[model samples]
Target: MATKTAARASVESNRNDDDEPESIPAPGAKRHHFLDPRRATGRLFVATAVGIVATCFAPVHLDWRIRAVLGWDTGALCLLVLAWNILVRSCPNETQRRAGAEDPGRNLIWAVTVLASLFSLFAAVFVLRKVRAWTGFEGQLWTGLALLAVVLSWLVTHTLYTFRYAHLYYRGGRADGLDFPKDQKPADIDFAYFAFTIGMCFQVSDVVVSCTRVRRAVLVHSLISFVYNTTILSLALNVAFNLLGDG
Candidate 1:
């Protein structure tokens, strides 16, 4: 009887131990929230400034007149994208926060986009020479080819980023990286959705502009803008569509 009582006591003690709550980290020991809108905006501002300077200094064989016009366009587009990203970071929704946590997959897409832009630029330069040679440059096949290349390049870059954003949302629940807090109000969600749609419209405009340009510098600038704009727009549209459909 004593042995049985001892065994029962031991089992009871073990059960009690198992039922005890595990030690959680102290509140003070927990990491503080690292995300800050001001810092993100600062980074974006620096990036935009750097792009403007780089575009200004980037050597090209084009005429001074062409350079001035296209350089401004390029710089403006880069700045716009940087600002857009900053805005995204500043007011990130849950989907955005999740997407931000993932690898951006920028390398391959950037390379392809750059290559396509370069090709379009060269084609534009070549077209100028052709225009000088031929009386009517409107019906030339090369013009069509140049536009096609720019569009394709922009499309490829846009697609890569769109896929990455989708992956991030799937993994983290935000498209841009701002995770909606547990107690976030419905109005905040609606605002984020609206911002996303506006961002997407900017992207579509970029593509449209890139394909219509006839100058090398103009084409390149348009292509770059198109890539940025398309990615932002597509992601936003996808989220909006899904949310509406769910409702």
Candidate 2:
């Protein structure tokens, strides 16, 4: 009887030890997920940019067809990314593994996103200024490209920050992290809603950020969104006025 009890205790101990490693994942493990911003958003952005660049070189007669293909591909990929996010959220096991894990690629992700944002701004301004000299269909094409670039840049920026907020929330745990309205921890989509609100409204909407670290992240995100949204709105107005003048 004594021997059997000791044996059972030993088995349970080993089982607990095996499960311990899952709690704190190995470095870079988080990036392997399909929904990781680096893997999902990064791939989508690259594909869209490639399609746009390819469309630029296409002959005038084929330009519309190329643009049509680009639009279809971009829209499809965006849907896939969103669907995958919702699927992962529905799976408790996957969400458990993702939560509270360190993201080793964060610095690289931030660097790339910031560079893209700056480039988008510069390109939009440049296109607006140069469109007057382009004339007719060429100017319209250039303007369209700038709009696409700006939209892509805006999407990529918010997407990256959305995941960044999730990571920080999980890493900080319930005690020192974001305070969602009801749930102890919210889904990635919830974070997406939070991020887009900040991007559009420059405010925190429903979620209450609880810690300094997250507050700092929110501040930076708000500032970037402010600049990006303001610039895009101004460019639209200017472009509208230009079209009116041309008319």
Candidate 3:
């Protein structure tokens, strides 16, 4: 009877084990999406806001002496944004050859942005020189030169990156996607692009000043950029109004 009971218990344990579900691995962990438009826009807004606040509270006047200096600084900022954009947009073969070179589309976007930045920098310098001449600010010559040097350095760095990435893209031997379409009227596009580029320049300068760990310089430079740009925009609007009114 004891032997019979043991055999029955063994049979019951075997049945229970057979009835249990087999373990299956969970679906491969979902990948986290890092780039979202909403997040990017939010970051841009925050950066712009911080820059504006720093400019407003800081005591700095947009005097003729400082106009050239501010112009150069703003130009540099525009250049950086353009370069950043290009870096995102460009798709190069070398980029894919390296580890973790996913998302060619984004790479292309960065490349375009960088190209735009270079153009904007050139435009800013041209515009600033005109502004300086118009305003008759001779004292800021040294400052202007310094700004030019910074811009030149940026251009050199950017050119090297551009050539390397472009070569990779051309040589990679990949199928081309839909080309980037140009939208908006030429004049309107130019104005909007320059305005936004200049705005970014102010924001970049603010970051630099803050990073220097000098609170006062940051505040002062921020204010200078804000006031100068404001004045410039106002003047530009006035000119447009007069031209349109005459037309």
lDDT of 2 by residue, 1-247 (tens): 9999999999986664332122244233454554444454445555556556665655667446335434533543463465356434543334434545643245645675676567566656766676677678867776776666667667767776766676665552322356777665467677778888999999998788876667877888898788878876577567767766876
Candidate with better lDDT, 1 vs 2:
2
lDDT of each: 0.39, 0.61, 0.36
Candidate 2 collision pairs: none
The alpha-carbon deviation from the true structure for residue 103 of candidate 3, after best TM-score superposition, in angstroms, is: 5.8
Best by lDDT: 2
Candidate 3 clash total?
Answer: 25
> Can you rank all candidates by lDDT, best first?
2, 1, 3
Whole-model lDDT for model 1 versus the true structure? 0.39
How many residue pairs in model 2 have overlapping backbones?
Answer: 0
lDDT at residue 99 of model 1 (Cα atoms) = 33
lDDT assessment of candidate 2: 0.61
Residue 190's lDDT in candidate 3: 28
Instruction: Write the residue-wise lDDT of candidate 3 on 1-247 in tens digits.
Output: 9999999999986663333222221233122233421122232344334434544443466454344334434444544464445444533322223212222232443443344344334434444445434433442344344345344433423333333222222222321111213422122122223223334364332112112212322233345345544643444444435434444
Candidate 1, backbone clash total: 19
